[model samples]
Target: MEINIPKGGITITKLLLRICSILIIIALVTSVDGSKGNSASPEESITILFTHDLHDNFLPFEVRRNQGKYTVGGYARLYSAIKEQREKDPDAVLVDAGDFAMGTLFQTIYASDSPGLRMMGQMGYDATTLGNHEFDFRARGLAASLRAAKDSGDAIPKIVATNTIFPTDDEGKIPANLQALKEAMDHYEVKDYLIVERKGIRIGILGLMGEEAASNAPMSGVTFDDAIESAKSTAATLKNDEDVDLVIALSHSGTSDEKSKSEDELIAQKVPDIDVIISGHSHTMLKEPILVGNTIIGSSGEYGEHLGVLNISLDVNKKWKVNEYKLIVIDDTLPLDPTTSETIEKYKQLIQEKYLRHFDMEFDEVLAYSPFDFTPFSEIGIELKEEPLGNLIGDSFIHTVRELEGNDYEPIAAAVMPYGNIRDSFGKGDITVSNVFNVNSLGIGPDEISGYPLLNIYLTGKELKTVAEVDASITPIMDEVQLYVAGLSYTLNTNRFIFNKVTDVRLQDFDGTKEEIDDHKLYRVVAGLYSAQMLPYVNEKSFGILSIVPKTKEGTPVTNFEDQIIYMNGNQEVKEWYAIANYLKSFDKIDGVPQIPVYYEQMKNRKVVEHNSNLFAVLKSPNRIIVTAYAILLAFVGIVVLIITLIVKRRRRKK
Candidate 1:
């Protein structure tokens, strides 16, 4: 066959044969191994059911805009599904990726008592990782959850967080509770990866959380490590050391669209060892798992609204491979296990009866009326641009400060507020007392900076322009400054481009006096502490720091800096403080109505007669009642004294 071959032809032929032989040998070995691995395979199958970001939204189906009939994702349904899956395959393992706490009102209440984790443990969760919200209560709350889970005595899901670390004490010793918690977690929890052996296949599961969540979270004592680095290190250990059939990452990172960057996608790309990524945090529902090389990524929407199921098959060598995966919508049509349903109902009832009783009395009362329905977009209207809602909040802060510090002190200036901070609106109707709670749902404390009585200052018209322009240019670094002032009003000249769009600056007095602003004059202000620290306009200027005040009007110290108290008192209630603005608007009124083109425009032409006052009727109503009661008591005493005096004088004269 090589009769006319070149000088090196024989050598080349020999080399080719050797290569072929090696390839054939490798193939034969692989086939044999695969066959041997499958020879002992049983007829029964194993399944793994997983979920994440079940933010305690345990209610039934509710449709939202853009997202179609989302009738899935409650613990009851998830419980039923898991039970059914377990019935089908007794070796089923259920796991949550994280974020099982802190979203709805239910979570807030349950977190106070560590009921969510306890119930999850009772429901047979194999293991769980810490999400950002798990640390919402910071070290103390997290410790409590861990303790409660441990106390449950059921096969509690091994709580695992490889990146979270505690600070060392003076002697470099971790706190006793933290040490005990870590030990308990290491003993009862899986610190790195868990290997679940079903039938003949071995599956390894690892947990990861987003780094950004730690910074954004209200947690103070704990810190998160670099996610990518931690993942890479964990993967290396699991693959090289643990030697499992397949690797899965339960990631609390996020999903992405074309415009958004996803940490999960990045993790998959950068760390190739991860076979499947069940992700949460971004609350994206992937129609199907995205395949990147040998790995697959999937996510269910936030709240217990969707269930993600991954079906995998193993080859003869016990090597795990994804067969198919889907996100199942949990609804009534799907079969629910009675046992799981009963368990969920019991917990729900226990939670309602034991913990949430105060919600009715404290959070559900009507406080005032709104003339129009309010939504996020309402802020765009000329009349609604400066939200009456925000103005009402600002007014409440002023009043709370005044009551705390007494009547003599006047607020100088206020800091800017963020648009995102405005959560809900006071729609036109009977504004329930709960509306105030909903609007100011942030549980911020009473401190001056991080607390409610934040000293926020407004810039001069020229300075406002400068601040606004700066905010626009450096969007990333700029603080989200979108504050609405109570006594002050102004207009934005969108046509004329300047630093900020403010025009026609004027000073407004609480006593109904109006005066033109001198650009050089400085003013005092008050606002929430976080806004004051983060907003560039306030921090950049030399506005003197007024005395710090408590966030609450009831003389409560600012303990929870994250909670904000909103009041639903009407705009007319704040009008007294805005006397200057009202007076100025009087000159421009067409028919006893302010001629300001927009609500925000009116804010530009106004000034602060009183920077922060506790005049918000919603907050002051209780105080006023007490004051009236005291006055009545004093009057009765005075009348008795007059009668006693007459009687004593007459008796003495007769004697």
Candidate 2:
């Protein structure tokens, strides 16, 4: 991507002037792109325009907060802002930390042809790292997308992903998709580090994916090396092999707690020589560049919400020092660039004609009205506790699947969805199809469709309740992974043993009928495809301490649960957002709009919190799992008492 340094003769607006005075202009001078030391004095400065987690929000939209309504963040606004900054400092490098894809409907066709990457390339991104979300389409998908982008002949930026696990072992069968990905990674020249001479100074740039990001990218078939180790090795290569003056690490690791395992800040502390670390993956918005030793760490927030501008100057000692840092808001206040807007519209039209038209859906068509927010993280948020929104979704899943299937379909005892699957919350206004799309945007079906299918599985009542127990236990460890169940309400005794937290499991029906959950009875359950894949992993992630299994209704253990996955319609996987939109539209309209029933405006106590007033209360209505745990505890106590009694008898005999 080429940078156009505008001449001073160009017209400047008041907002640009204010931004220049407040955040843009810097006293320091530095040259951009080519040869070490030629024109600029040591006092000159260089600029780095950074953005992260854009997530395909190329159009500006209004966010109605409780305080007020404000428009924020789009390609046009961001382009205008970046152009203005470049006008002042022509040598500024535009780079994104990571996670620039796989959020919106635009990303649905990424594997075929990635418009997002093309747009970024057009926007003049100097370089960017591969974020966790980049792997959303899986190994072959990424390979295909990269190939597609290259084949498109768009001026895409340098995509650097250091510390990847290449997997060279020939013992077992390697998947074709994975093999294709490895080849594509090599063919595309996805590098660990690159040296670009900015003005007269050699700038060494390296990229690393953090541990969390690696974990999040389960579908990628690519594992990552240690973040610190990757950064250190790359820095060493750059400083020694390349002989660069400044070293920058575009780290998707992110700043985190000081003692946390591997974060951006930890990388900076461990790897000393990196000049600046642009952090990502954690979605942290650090307003000012954090100084750790000599390195400056900066991160902008997620979803094109903000742009980070970092200005640095060379000191007398020839060391780089941060002169300014701004996490500039990409709100409606900024003017839209006509060229970028035109490009964005072109893509939108293409998406409408090629994609949405098939489903009779428009990008911004209003589908329903929400009297209150149904967002995953709103007040009475689904993840915060058992919430109304979750209940609504769970109920919706059951309804949609049942309708899609014939009347003779096996009765589902309950339908459940993980809070992680529900992405965005609904605002207290008109809910558009796009809004619904935002809520459950992450999934792809077996048929290569855009959404995950709802799968039918069966589990013993004991195991079913255990699924809820997994929610209570894993919530603190994994944010938003908690399950929101529909068929039953389980009381959680926090004071009880970790894996044995849920109790009082009761089967609940849509008609409000309830019954005790039978321990031996196998009941049919429904879950989103993503949630189904994760069910087997919960026990593995918990170190096999919590043995969770979703069996068939006959109680036959499902070794390959993927085969059991069911589409709601004939060859049509359950598209979550579509299901949600259809469900909402099914609601009886008020004022000619399908108004949300007053039923969902508050919490739904699917999982009741039972504060253990005593040990007995904590262990009440113990399922087999809880009973076994309690027995073990009692046995341990009995053994201790027996030992104490023996010791006392011996002392008495001695006396």
What C-alpha lDDT do the candidate models reach, one value each?
Answer: 0.55, 0.78
Error (Å) of candidate 1 at residue 544 is 17
Best-fitting candidate, measured by lDDT?
2
Candidate 1 regions exceeding 4 Å error are 1-48, 61-63, 66-73, 84-92, 109-112, 167-172, 175-190, 258-260, 314-322, 331-417, 420-529, 536-655
- Mind giving the per-residue lDDT tens digits that candidate 2 earns over 1-655? 4334477443456556777776534523322433333233467788899988888778765565676667788899998889889998888988888888877777777787778888899989888889988888788778887888778888988888878776655776556658898777777678888767675667888888888788888888877898888888888887776778778888888776655753887888999889888888887888777888888999888778788999998788766788889978888779988989898878777778766765678888889888875543434333336777788888888777777776777788888788778766776789887777777788677767466767788888777877888888777677668778898877787777677777667887765678887878888998877787678888787777776687876777777766777654355566777777778878998888898988887655678876676978765676566677779999999999999999999999999
Q: How far out, in Å, is residue 177 in model 2? A: 2.9
Residue range 243-296, candidate 1, lDDT tens digits = 655677888887778424678888888888777788878778788778776678
